[model samples]
Target: APRCSRDEAEISPFCSLPEHQAPRCSRDEAEISPFCSLPEHQAPSCPVCCGPIRGLATRLPSCQRSRSAVTCRLSGTLLDEDNPPLVLPSGHVYAEAAVLRLEAAHGGGAFRDPRTDDVVTMGSLRRAYFL
Candidate 1:
């Protein structure tokens, strides 16, 4: 007896019998099956074939480590997306307004980077380009 595709087996009354198991269909048979002739019978719900599924999972974009580091220490708030960030010489970045407030509170003297013990000044601050 000739084999039928899973799609054809699902719809054909001869192949649906519990006593008569249908054989797997070849690529050529799959293309010419009676079930493949119609568009509505092509869905996965029709029947699951005994073969590996193609492109089962989709790929996603990689995560950005820098974006997760855009939190301010002084204000405890996230950096503004529109504003450029202030990068300290000690390699720490913070919101511009927060750094300015800290400098003002300390009377324009050297302030410590919370992440590191290194002393930094307003002159040591520069604009950072974070993507």
Candidate 2:
């Protein structure tokens, strides 16, 4: 069966049993969407890319890693969609190829989300934001 929309799921929590057990909410007996259950402090998380969660994890995967920081590339258009076109801290203009190269250069690591200060890939971006 097709899953309902997020708003509908919010309104009609009892209507379906998630394939995974229903997530307990910290607020409102009126069940919260599993997707929205993460504590507010742990934001900018990309669940799709980051995969299964454990407990109230409050930091991004990037924050947990102890590696030298990688450069993130962005175009004016992508930046416009996500944020204002302020000059990059790195002062670089990233075309699509540059993004591709970034992925390659990072040894196929995920893209770091500038907005959220998290790491996410293109596939994860589509799932978490678009869907």
Candidate 3:
């Protein structure tokens, strides 16, 4: 039978061997961690968070579908080339200076009218922008 006891081996693996094992200290003790330690956590933010932002927020000369994959109007001319109207996909229409934010179902993005500076429904401005 081996002379070394389990308790002694548990305390020190090197006890049976000629070389001494590294020390094991409590949290209070300052000791270097293992060479290959796992990280605590990863970055929570994802690139897809702004997926809708890039799709709808950008200034599109014509109408296009948003990241949510919804066809909507981004901008349009209200009174011919001289005046323009801004509309969003939500169905709300504004003349000037109105702000509209797309919901999660829509695209989870924000749209502001350059002409009226307002938020308008996406459907309303499609023809003017696309055509």
Candidate 4:
């Protein structure tokens, strides 16, 4: 098991070993911690914590999905340059023409989110682009 000073353990519990294996010492004793062999909790074992971080980074990745994976909620199709994509404040995506028609159907006042019914406006719609 990697070692960590008590202070390091306190600051980042993930840096320390299991509870049963943790060496206990009186706060006044100033004894060496079995985990880190340090007089006081100061140093941290980077290996232990780095492993978890790297593991999570591998298990869950980012920016791996392509733009074609994004589908418009209104049209139920992949967003394209011809139709373009618009995003509401509520994070709902729709084709530009579809948003215009929906807003016109609502008489051009504050529009409501189809899913949550939160009021938004056509002007509040923002264009979405992916690279």
For model 1, state the Cα shift of residue 58 in Å: 23
The lDDT-based order of candidates, best leading, equals 4, 1, 2, 3
Q: Candidate 1 on 1-131: residue-level lDDT in tens?
A: 63434544544555555544634433443223465335433334222321232121111111233324455645656676654589999777778878777777677766767667677888878888756
Tens digit of lDDT per residue, candidate 3, span 1-131?
Answer: 64334544544454476434434323344332342122221111322123443333222122222322112223321323333334445443333322333333345354545435564444445423323
Q: Could you give candidate 4's per-residue lDDT for residues 1-131 as a string of tens digits?
A: 54555445544544556767655533344432355323232222333224444333322212222223555656555677877898889887778767777778788866667767887887888888898
Q: For residue 80, give model 4's deviation from the true position in Å.
A: 1.5
Q: Using lDDT as the measure, name the better of candidate 3 and candidate 4.
A: 4
| lDDT of model 1, residue 52 | 34
Top candidate by lDDT: 4
Model 3 segments more than 4 A misplaced: 1-110, 129-131
Off by over 4 Å in 1: 1-69, 81-83
Error of 1 at 112 (Å): 2.2
* Preferred candidate (TM-score higher): 1 or 2: 1
Measured over all alpha carbons after superposition, the RMSD of each candidate to the real structure, in angstroms, is: 20.3, 16.0, 23.0, 17.7
User: Cα deviation of 49 in candidate 1 (Å)?
Assistant: 45
For candidate 2, list the clashing residue pairs, or say none: none
Candidate 2: RMSD to truth: 16.0
TM-score of 1: 0.40
Q: Which rank order by TM-score, best down to worst?
A: 4, 1, 2, 3
Return whichever of 2 and 3 wins on lDDT: 2
